[model samples]
Target: MSTLSFLLLFLSTFAFIAGGSAAKSWALSDNNWGLLVLTLALYSAGNLIMLRLVRDLGMGVALSLSGFVQLLAVNVVAFFIFGESIAPLHAAGLVLGIVAVALMTYPV
Candidate 1:
């Protein structure tokens, strides 16, 4: 993928991550309407950027890379921001997900 594509993907990924954070906050704060709106807006913007990415990098490759990156990022948000813990099994699963991404994205 091109550098531009990478940058776009990262932006969209962060958007999605922020949306997730907003969603969690919304739930925690008794379903705040503003946070819910922010969550939807972030996810929508992320998807729009992702649609551009599909043009730049093929859907399969783009989503595979994006999904893997999101998986790792969400874990970080879950841990540090949410004060969550990771078990050994979950770590193993994350490693396996990394392997799956590598296999999925390798040049044909």
Candidate 2:
């Protein structure tokens, strides 16, 4: 990937992570119906950004890298911000996910 495309992908990934973090906050609201709407809006923006990045970079690289970035972001947020714990199984799953991304994104 070109440097500019890589930078865009990185920024898109960060936006996705930020949007997802904001989305998770909606779960705490008592009026749960609005939560779904708000979360969708946030996620949609993230997806749009991701789509643009993918267009610039190509699907295999964009998606695989984004997937790993997002997974790590979610895990960190879940553990630190949300006070959630990852069991051994969850950690194993994360490792597997990372491996899959690596394999898929590797140059042929």
Candidate 3:
């Protein structure tokens, strides 16, 4: 991938993490309108970046890479930033996800 595509993917991953965090907070709280709004905006931005990624890299590669990145990023944020627990199963799942992404993106 080009430098620009890498940057866009990074930004998109960050947006997914931010949006998921906000959504988690909103769900935990009784009512957090600010978080709700922030989540929506972040998710929208992430989607826009994802569109660009699909355009640049094609749907299969872009979606696979982005989905794995987002999954890992959100899990890390949930565990470290939000003090959520990560069980052994969750760790295994993450490892499997990484492996899957690697296989999917490997050059033919």
Model 3 per-residue lDDT tens digits across residues 1-108: 999999999999999888998899999998889999999999999999999999999999999889878877887788799898878997898889889987897889
C-alpha root-mean-square deviation, each candidate: 1.3, 2.2, 1.3
Residue ranges of candidate 3 with Cα displaced over 4 Å = none
Give the C-alpha miss distance for residue 20 in model 1, angstroms. 0.8
Q: Over all chains combined, what TM-score does candidate 1 have?
A: 0.91
Q: Report the lDDT tens digits of candidate 1 across residue range 1-108.
A: 789998998999999999999989998998789999999999999999999999988899899989989988998999999998989998999899988987898888
How many times do residue backbones clash in model 2? 0
**Which segments of candidate 1 are over 4 A away from where they belong?**
none
Deviation of model 1 at 44, angstroms: 0.4
When summed lDDT is taken over every stretch of 10 residues in candidate 3, the lowest stretch is: 67-76
Per-candidate total of colliding backbone pairs: 0, 0, 0
C-alpha positional error of residue 51 in candidate 2 after TM-score superposition, expressed in Å: 2.0
TM-score, candidate number 2: 0.80
Query: By summed lDDT, which 10 consecutive residues of candidate 1 come out lowest?
Result: 98-107
Using TM-score as the measure, name the better of candidate 1 and candidate 2.
1
lDDT-sorted candidate list, best first: 1, 3, 2
What TM-score against the true fold does each predicted structure earn? 0.91, 0.80, 0.90
